[model samples]
Each structure stands twice: as C-alpha cells, then as structure tokens.
Target: MVLGAVVLWELLAAFLERTMDESVYEYLDFVDATDSRIPRRSTRAPGLAKALSLLRGDGRALLFAGTVFLVGAAGSAGHNFLLWQLQDQGSSGLLMGLWVGLGPLAELALHPLRGQLLRALPGCGLELLSLAVLAAQLLSYSLLRAPWAALPVQALSGLSSGALRWRLQGTVGDVATPGSERALLALLGGLCAAGAGLGGLGGGFVLQRFGLALLLQASCAGLGLWILFVLIVRSRLPRRRKINYSRLLAAESSEMSDSEEENEDWLVKAMRDESFNRNWIQQHGIK
Candidate 1:
C-alpha cells in the first residue's frame, strides 16, 4: 500500500507539474564547513567506517545517536507489551486496524502546523513533549480495561510519533553536512533498527518471564532514561542560532558548479596528455 501510494503520488505530481514552495527547501537545509561538494559521493550507502568516524569525531553527535537508539529500543519494548495487552483484551481485527491507522492519520493532519510549532518550541522541546505523550499512552494501556478505550489514545500516540519524526528530520538539517544528508539518515536508521531488535529481544524475555504489566512498567523506565539523556544534551548545547538558508542555498549552488568545472578540467587534461603521448610515440617510432 505504501508503494502504491508513492507511485500514485508520483504520477499525479508529474501530471500536475506542481512546483514545490521554497519554504520546503528552507526547512530541510543543513550546513557544515567540512562537507564536500561531491554530494553523490557523500550520499552513497554509508559504511561502518563512516559511522565510526562520525561518532569518534563529535561527542554531541554520539549523544544524539545514543538518544535515538534508546528511543527506538523503548518504543519497540512498549509496542510488544501493547500488542500483548490488546491480545489479552481480545481486540477485534477491525478495531485493531482502526487503532493502528488513526495515529498516523492524526500525525499526517498535523504536518502543516509543525513548522509554526518548531518556531514556538525548540526541537528538543518537541521531542520531550512527544516522550511525555508516549508515556501517557503507555499508562493508558496499562490502566484501561477495555481495548476500545485505547483507540482514542492511539491518535495522541500518533501525534507523538509525528512530532518525534519531525524533530529527527530537523536534527538532520541542523547537524548533517550539506551533501551528506542521505548517508547520515541511513546511519541513524540503522542504529534505530539495531536498537529496536535489542528491545524486542529483551521485551520478549521480560514478557515470558514476568508479565505484561511489568513489561509496560519497564518500558516506561526505558523512556525515562531516554528523556534524561535528551535533557542532559539539550542543557549542554548552546542557544539555537538562526540560520540564513538563502545564503546556504547559494553556497551549495556555487559549490556544485565549482566541482563540475574541476571535473571537466581534469577530463580535458587527461585527453591532452593522452594525445601528446600518442604523438610523441609516433614521432619516436615507438609503439
């Protein structure tokens, strides 16, 4: 269904020739002095070396990565317990579908307003708020007797998910090098996946050994640890600086142009050298 939606959107967009607003780019831009002009090279599939380099070079980046990993881990743990709770409650398939779908829909409904919200609150604030909401949702799941009661909670849960996603994207813009966004995104995604796997493994053990209530409680504690990390990092970081995105855009354009010119010059030089070698060989009666 996601693939179908992507294809449908692409077809419609091509038919409409709809131009995106400049504000989209403004929201998505990241700047770094050490970044290279060869975006295609930087944006290639990230390797272990790149991840190591990123972690070893920047302590703050390491903290951010750790936070993401913890969040993913806790979320997956909560999810396992949530499924178990719903199953125990004998939730109907249709009701389960509604519970699952409504949250992302609520999130999608709020995307247009995310920009204004970010202006009013820092990304960390949004992240903290999302964590708070997730905590509430888990509490609801723990307390609510009926599975249907958890349906409305899913909407708010979706809102938290959306907020976190928006904050993460903004973090990428804030921290990623201009040309390395794709690679950085890939690295973060892998970490989240790994964390989720670990969480799932632990959650299953806890559920089988203890019970569902204990699992939910443990997930809450995990989220608390994640919140602590976020708070510590947020407190340490300097005040947010306003970025001049227009200047960054111009700089990126100029950088791309210079890189292309350099590549062309290299090609020309290589051709000239090859021709000179051929001529010299003919004159000297060499093969």
Candidate 2:
C-alpha cells in the first residue's frame, strides 16, 4: 500500500507541477491528503502532463528529507517525556533537546568511523551502551531531589543515546540486503513510529499512576532488559568484518605518522568549518 501510494504521489506530483505550477510544500500537502484517503487498491491513469518539480528528484532533496525525518522523531521524543519535567524541574522541550544532544556531542571521537563501526559491530553493543546510561540517568533522575543535579544525568543519557542511535540506524541499514532493503526500511520506520506512539502513551501513564520514582525504576529495568537482549541475540547478526575502535585510534604513533604541519592544517580547517559544535554549549543553558 505504501509503495503504491509512493507511485501515485510521484504521478500526481509530476502532473500538479506542470499544470498548477505548485510549490513542493503544496505538493506535499496534496500527497499527504491523498495518503490519508488511499483505498485498498485501485490504479491506472498517468494523470496530467509531466512537470519536473524542483523538490522531487533533486540530489539535495534526499538529504533534506533525511534530516527532516530524524529531527521530527527527535523533537517528538523530547516533547513527550522530557517536556513533562518542566512542571517540577522547569524542563521544556528545548531543554530536553539540549540535554540529549550531549551524547551525540561526546561521539565526536567516533564520527569518522560511524558507518564502518556500526556495520562491524553488533546492534546489541550499541543498545547495551545506551541502556546502561539510560538506566543510570533514570535512576539518578528519580533519586535526586535537586533538579539541577539531575540535569547532568539527562545530558549523559543524551550522549549515550546519540551513539546508540547512530549505531542503530547503521546496523538496521546493514541488516537489510538489496532485495529486502525497501521492505526492511519501511518495517524499521513503522517500528520506530510505533515505539514513539507507545512512548507518548506510556509516558503519560507513568506520570499519572506510578509517579517519578517508580517510573524511573521501571525505565531503568526496561532498558536493562534491552541491554540483555542485544547482548544475547543481536550480537549474532551476520558480519563481513570485525571492527576495533581502540585499534583505529591508536596511541603508538611511531609508524606512518603525519607531519605536524599536515595535522595542524586539518585541525584548523575542521574547527573553522564545523557548525554542529553547538550542542555542548547549548546543554548548560537548559538547566
């Protein structure tokens, strides 16, 4: 059904662009509406004349779509759980974003090898690291009376989260082959959406019934189970090569080392061009 909708959207978007000369956002709206009303199965009809929309097939469009996708999910997660802390801890949606952004910040050391390392490692490894931190953070969150002291725990959760997230996506992509990629990606996306939807529901339930302490304890234990599952089951996924993070960033800089000038040149260039270095500075502002 989704695939058929994609095809229909492609056709309608093509025709609408040619006749109405619409914007991509307009096309998006039309397609969204169409998606809502898409019946079981019925097709045939090329629609109107073709028009090459600016946003449809462009190379940069894919990048934009991917970014929009991730940001939407991340934003939703923040609004659901962390935003609730505002009543007691003065935590807002923005605060949650700021704090969780820390884990990704800490992963600066692992950025270059993200895809490579994820493909090499088990999904369980990332899940375990994430759950361990999440468990600890949640425990601290419930234990501390001081909200300011607890805020750093959220940041720690974020750092661990960032690494786990990056690894998860990479591993999921790696798990599905060319033959099954589309269905696998769709399944993965649906699972994510389902989880988020459940989280929204479950989070509210926790706040209402069990209270913070019980909720935190449950969250910790739940994540701990995730760690166990990953360690036992996901660790056995098919792998082409083994990855070693420590070896990649070696301390024995005795052989085939770059000159001081070359190293300094790269460092300076990176510092000048990098823009994502804001998360660290933004985190403290949340508390």
Q: Using lDDT as the measure, which candidate wins?
A: 1
Error of 2 at 70 (Å): 18
* Weakest lDDT window of 10 consecutive positions for candidate 1: 25-34
* Model 1 clashing residue pairs (backbone): none
Residue-level lDDT of model 2, residues 69-160, one tens digit each, is 33234333344554455446665666566665654565675567666655565534554565576567666766766445645665564445
C-alpha lDDT of all candidate models, in order: 0.75, 0.53
In model 1, where do residues sit more than 4 Å from their true spots? 1-48, 55-60, 238-287
RMSD of each: 16.2, 24.1
Model 1 / residue 262 / CA error / Å: 41
Which candidate has the highest TM-score of all?
Answer: 1
Task: Kindly give the stretch of ten consecutive residues in candidate 2 with the minimal lDDT sum.
Answer: 44-53
Q: How many backbone clashes does candidate 1 have?
A: 0
